[model samples]
Target: MESQSSLQRLLSGPIAPGELAWIGLRPARRASMIPVSAAKLAPGEGLEGDHYISSRNGPRQVTLIAAEDLAAIGQFLAGAGAQPEQLRRNLVTRGVNLLALKDRRFSIGPVILEGAGECAPCGRMEETLGPGGYNAVRGHGGILARVIEGGEVRLGDPIERIEEDISTVLARRRNR
Candidate 1:
């Protein structure tokens, strides 16, 4: 059996906060994304002006990619750097391990987001990233999330993991 400290180390530790490096919104299906400095997120609506807002699915309200992963993808493709627009994700973050936030609620500026799952690479990756684009983005595809509390998220906002219990955070927000 693991000791208390060891268990704690495995379960909880100092959070490495990340930064919101970029934001993009697709205004229409199959359209190129437009970079934005800030955007409003809403429950069940995704980003206010994003094409995904109308998506019937709830778990895919937002998509995020780590800048580090993008760099890795670029290196994997022989210096072919992949841009945020090419990935088709809504947000690009740096320094945080997105997979670590699985099943957890986190704060990105004023917005509260619940991690849903991995945003697997789709067929479009090849068309966007070139020959091995699909394979390049295979494991670096980032994460999907649901908006828990809608609010404005701006470029350069700190992406932080919520240390408090999600229930406690939600309760406090409700009481406010």
Candidate 2:
């Protein structure tokens, strides 16, 4: 047995679980996102009814945003909290640091997703959220992920990190 370094321990520390607060699906490009209580996730494909689908897995198989971030975006403009659909993200989560999921494997119920990168806000935000919309979402756009294991993701499903830190993984690789 060996003692762990403080930084390593901190990186591997526990994260409080969060629940899936909302779900939205875009039926087609430029279509209004429809709020849904549940949706099916298919590996290599996106949400069953959502338009952003492909035969092969991609970085943006699905997109998610934090509920807190949405509120922050709203505060930037006249105390108007934008709706989940207005953000154009596939899911809206609450009570969790979504950045923690970046570059890590996390699970939403039985569905597994590997955080691909930051879900940068698109120019469309201006049109969707009104004035200053794009700037409002600048640092709070949430994250995008690729589905590694597919299953149903329903509202109220628990979201939890189920993997080791990427730093630990990189260290192991370097040592080997």
Candidate 3:
């Protein structure tokens, strides 16, 4: 079995304009595209929603704030921690396959999500980059998920995988 340290990370783009490239410790499926009525989206408040739309036939795309990175950033800002620079993922996903999360089902806290599609970067990234943000995540798929269950998600929370190997399950279902 691969150690947790061996888990690959996916870097789609930067967090904000003028910010460094953002890396997802584990990229996940973009669920329903529904809007999560969590706390207000602030600069440092974590979660933020943009006007960009991924699927017209699907739900709205809601950007998730990685609780892990937020906690680390918050701690450093509070002067109670010492850590190196870290990549801030918009969505903190677990369990569900980071690469095959789309069109699938997963959960956070107690909420079950209906993975819709990919969260690709847009031209607005260029505005944030002031020059080359558009090219940052050209082919990379950033995560976009609709909140199935609304609950406070903090760092260290587990993104339990309902299916151990999605491909295997899917193949079996198809054969049936």
RMSD (CA, Å), each prediction: 2.4, 6.0, 13.0
Model 3: number of backbone collisions: 6
Q: What is the lDDT of residue 77 in candidate 3?
A: 40
| Whole-model Cα lDDT of every candidate shown, in order | 0.90, 0.87, 0.38
Model 3 residue 28 CA deviation (Å) reads 25
For model 2, residues 88-165, the per-residue Cα lDDT tens digits are: 899999988998888888889878888899999889999999989999999899999988778899999999997666
Off by over 4 Å in 3: 1-58, 64-90, 93-97, 164-176
The lDDT of model 2 is 0.87
**What TM-score, computed on C-alpha atoms, does each candidate reach?**
0.90, 0.86, 0.42
Q: Return the candidate ranking by TM-score, descending.
A: 1, 2, 3
- Write one digit per residue (lDDT tens) for candidate 3, span 35-105: 23232222222233432322222333334333333344334345332111122234543223343555545
Better of 2 and 3 by lDDT: 2
Task: Report the lDDT of model 2 for residue 119.
Answer: 94
Task: Give the C-alpha miss distance for residue 37 in model 3, angstroms.
Answer: 15
Which of the two, 2 or 3, has more TM-score? 2
